[model samples]
Target: MATWLTTFSYWLLIQSFVITIILLPLSHLLVSYLPLYLFNYRSHDSPSRYLLFITLFIPFTIIFLLITDLSHIVILLFFVWFSVLLGFIDHQTGYLPDLLVYPLLVLALLFHAMQSNEQLLLAIYGALVSYLIFWFIYGFFKLAIKRRGLAQGDIKLVAAYGAWLGVYILPYLMLLSACLGLLNYILLWIKIRYKPDKIAFGPALASAGIGLMLIKYFKEDWLIKIIL
Candidate 1:
């Protein structure tokens, strides 16, 4: 069983890498037709080739390493792919289209449903909780500061992440995302010596989601063990 698992892991790694390489160029064409908001249409530009390659490669490698179950790996590969797409779109156009995010939410719910009834319930709860929390924050910022703290697309993105990862992990996701955002802000300030009025939060959130997923994947071996 151990040997078989190792062999399977290697095979998946190779296959995923090859697929990523093939899909990199094709992604440029696909990005053109993405459902972007009217305002974003003017800013629709492709991500750099290096950025695209890194995005595809990291998720594939992480998912392949962390998931022992083949079915779980397949589902996560889909999740990772779409998360990257959303991140790319947000980075490029500062918009997260419902066309992509809603389908991802549906897929995450379906994936959890296949796992068990309890998991499905947790996913639903996560989605609702995440959305409501963000909605509250949005309202608070609007009323208190007279500015939008988060875009609607960002709220939906977190909700989708909740559906995929479960409610229990939402806090960690948020914390990690905030940390990443702060780091990004600091880096930009240092490099450019000027802070932009707006920063795309989706990429940081997506990155946090991915990072937490990897932690969850290896929890049994390392995280849980350490905690216990």
Candidate 2:
């Protein structure tokens, strides 16, 4: 029985890896085409060249994530689609647009509703709670501390995560993001001749979102349960 299971798993992994490799060229095309398609980035020739290199690194990530199930693959598809869109937007302009966020919100709501009552509620609650928490924090900090440290983009990005991950998971995600973000900030300070404001929080938010998504799918409950 163990031998059979091992053989089946190996076969599945090979098939999925093959499919992902075949898709790499297509992903390359998307990375290149995304800049031109996004209107604002049609003029920039260099970033697309770099993005193609980034696309090449994407396959291993795809294969690693695919080791789990089809649902995760679908989630990754959506995540990649959104990430590409945002990447283009960020590359062209200095902002992550509301245009993508609105559509994502609609799609997420529709997707959850189609799934079931529990999912719909969880998604909605996640979005609402995350948004409000961030919003209040931003406002309070802005008033009392007299500083605008956290960007609204970060708030909306976390709100978007609400549609995908569990409500409880959002807090953990935020905590993880804070820790990692600080580490990244310090690394950037030491390595790059750039300031903190030069590096946008949107990328950090994207990384955090990806990290949470990966942990939710790949990490076993016992790992989190024991840690928590």
Scored by TM-score, the top model is 1
TM-score of 2: 0.69
Instruction: Please give, for residues 75-128, the per-residue lDDT of candidate 2 as tens digits.
Output: 455664565555445544546667666666666676677669998999999899
Q: What is candidate 1's local distance difference test score?
A: 0.80
| Whole-model lDDT per candidate | 0.80, 0.62
TM-score of each: 0.88, 0.69
Clashes of each: 0, 0
| Best of the candidates, lDDT | 1
Residue-level lDDT of model 1, residues 1-228, one tens digit each, is 123245457777787789788878876545555734434475435468788778888788767665668887777877877788788777777788787789889988988898899989999999999999999999999999999999999999999999877888898888889998888778878888998777788889888887777666567664455732
- CA deviation > 4 Å runs, candidate 2: 1-45, 48-72, 84-93, 193-195, 219-221, 224-228
